[model samples]
Target: MQHFPTGQAEHKRHRRLARRNANGIYNWIMTNDVFYRKVLAHLKHDYSKLEQHARELEQANVALEQDNVDLRNALLAKEQQTAELQREIEAQTKASGACTRRWPARRNQVWSDGWNRLTNELAEAEATKYREKSKTRRRKIKALKNRVRTAVATSNSFEQWLLFVEQEKQDVETLLARYKKKLQAQNRIMTEARVLARELRRSAESTIFNSSTTVNSWCSTFERGIAHVIVAGELFSTSPATSDGSSCLRSDSELIYGMSTLEGLETARRGSPFSRSS
Candidate 1:
């Protein structure tokens, strides 16, 4: 309890209060500075993240633009190809129409010529066939004419041959009739001669036994008599031998006279004018 001055105490009390207030304000300022430093660090991290996102967006936009440029180039090339195809189609259509208009007359002319040629060939072939047929028919007709001529000539020759054969047959028949009559006459003469020869032989045999003449003399006389008789008969009759040898037999004188007469007849025949003329 020390007693002091009022002005000093009062001054000391005011200074103490002011110093407490100042210390409280300084603690508040320190708290606020720490909070501001933490906030600044968070803001700095957000700003760096925003800058990286912006760089990625820019790279994606650039790639999209390049893809759009490639698509536009492909579209333009496709449009050019479509236009060229359309032009080619129109040119082909026009060319086909022009060929169709120009070809019909030429085609018809070719067809008509071919048809005419075929008809001419057929006509020529038919004419050839007709000519061949006519030639064959003419040959057949000529051969038939030749056969007819040959047949007619052969028939004429056959008729002539038949006439000749008939003439020969008639001549043969006449000759056969004459030969038959002659044969009958000769047969009768032969029969009479045989009978006469048998009688004469018997008579000569008896005469030979009784007569005084020799056998040789008798044979000579008999031969002379027979010769005279044959000569006389030939001069007088158609036959050389007498029909009856016995009847024709004569005496020696008579035989000699007959022989002389035959000689005279032969001489007269030679001297006759009719014999010389024949």
Candidate 2:
């Protein structure tokens, strides 16, 4: 077990160890180069994948922004429409309120006979105008319908039918437009009529106020004349007159002054010409 090696055997063993060490160094270098290449490749692949993901995210963000813009526009449009509808609702409500509140007062309240007659006349005029307008529209519609029927019945070919169809469409559109225009005009006229009625009411009230003021002024003047007459009567009673015996009698002007409103009273009793006109 303790025997030493010979020179030849020891030489071979040393040579084999030196060759194995050289091969190990070469193998280590090659393996390290391969590992480095694999690591570099993985790094590049990961970078490429990350870049692709970032681009996809950017595209998705762009699409989301576009969608958001469209949604905002739609929301704005809806808000605008809501505003318009609200305004229309307010206007319609006001119109209805006005129509309901004032239309009956003209009939119930008492004013000048002229005002009553004017209200009646305006109402009659409106009714007649509306009746005539409705009749005219209906007549025109009937005539148009008859014409369309005639055209349809007389058509002999497809071309003729097509022509008639086009004409019918045009006629229908024209009728619709006419109806629309008439309805618009009717609403406008109704609004104008309400305004006119309100104006008339105001004017009537003004007239009554002015009449009352005039009546007050006339009463003041009459009262002053009466005072003066009483003073004159006292003076006449205290003074000595000639033998004419005219002190007990009033003059025509005095009598007329005392009853200054007799004619108006009689006229009121007889009914005014204005009330009679209705």
Candidate 3:
């Protein structure tokens, strides 16, 4: 029993030393845990700030995309408008060129037509003048032929006719003077004839004559002869009178008187002196 009490005292002293060392180790572990917790909280705050910046950048990118789409649409519209304007300008230019090309041709055509019409009118006028001149020349030729035929008829032979024609040229001048006096006489006769005709017409209207055959016949014969002489004088003024002046003598009594008087005049003309006038 004495040995057992000594062993218990030593064991109690060793247990006290081991307990103090364990207390020191526990204090060091607690301090290290507190430091680690503080470091982790700081890292978490940095990560949150990075996340917020990323979200803002995504919103800005979306806005930029929308603005790019609007700009592309505006550019397309402007290009379409420019193309339309260019086409319109080209069409107008072509039309103007075509008009310019046709103008001179149209003007020339009008001028040519006018010139042709004027030329035709001038030609027609010239032709008309030529035709009129030809008609006048034909009339003159016919008159000259009648004069030549009358000259030939008044002579006995061709040689005599030439000589007679030359002599008749002087006689014609004298005949022209005589013709003027004859014309005055004819005018007086015509006046007398007209008065006689008027008296006859009035008598015919007033008197109902049952036997007017002889008177009517004589009147017709006298008028017809007078008209014939007048017409012959007008047509052949240069021709010699008939041998006994038969063309001038109208009634039977006048024919006898004219023949006697013309024969006396011819005898006198032949018997007159052949002295030349100065």
Instruction: Judging by TM-score against the true structure, name the best candidate.
Output: 1
- Using all chains and alpha carbons, the TM-scores for the candidates as numbered come to 0.34, 0.26, 0.23
- Stretches off by above 4 angstroms in model 3 are 1-97, 155-278
Off by over 4 Å in 1: 1-84, 124-278
- Best-first order by lDDT: 1, 2, 3
Clashing pairs in 3: none
When 1 and 3 are scored with lDDT, the better candidate is 1
Q: What is the lDDT of residue 137 in candidate 3?
A: 89
Q: TM-score for model 1? A: 0.34
Q: What lDDT does model 1 reach?
A: 0.59
